[model samples]
Target: MDNIFKSAMRGALFFAAACLLLWGIVPEWKSVCAGLLLGAFASFMNALLLRRRVEIVGQAMANRGMRKMGLGLGSRIAMVLCVAMVAYKYPETFNLPATLAASMVMPFILLVSAFLHHKRH
Candidate 1:
């Protein structure tokens, strides 16, 4: 429960920071809000899903003696395909620049989550 709260707070902070940055650059409150909300949601979802998938792959690697490099390559390819599909399906909602920004924000989300998790431990 504590860990979950910490993670949520971390995600919120990341979202706010990203929003502020976007607002500063774009100077449009509505667009900035939309972009920030969508970007933060995407980043959070990506982190959660990717973490689960990576854990499964890690377990498989441990059991089968698989190479980490192959896992890394596969994950990268999967991410690209997933992003492409999203972009294709929702072009209006996700343009190239917004998608790029959202992608860039994901690592910050993950880093915040990790930091909170580590602090709890």
Candidate 2:
């Protein structure tokens, strides 16, 4: 699982870097690229947060330390909401549709990473 997450994160980071490069080279599509960059960044942070929470849950379960612990969905939602708000606030600088679409990309990244990892191993 950790290896899969790391692979997905590397893919996401590469994507974000590409977006940044596009933003620099293409002035006309700056808004769209900026949106993609922000969304990808947010998605990365959310994944990291989720990974940490899952690790914590696993540790707790192993130790029988807690009865119930949420996976921090509320915080993740808040982070996404914040990204949406930022895109909304800067309509000229960020495309909302692109931002929203990009934000949902991490799960797919994770899926593909896992698939490739499984195939390789």
TM-score of each model, in listed order = 0.49, 0.93
Query: 1-121, model 2: which lDDT tens digit per residue?
Result: 9899989989998999899899899899999999998888888888988888888888889998974667499989888899999999999989999898898889999999999999999
Residue pairs in steric clash, candidate 1? none
Candidate 2 to truth, TM: 0.93
lDDT value, residue 9 of candidate 1: 49
Off by over 4 Å in 1: 1-28, 65-99, 116-121
Q: Which candidate has the highest lDDT of all?
A: 2
Cα deviation of 58 in candidate 2 (Å)? 0.6
Cα lDDT of candidate 1 equals 0.60
Clashes of each: 0, 0
Candidate 2 local Cα displacement, residue 108, angstroms = 0.9
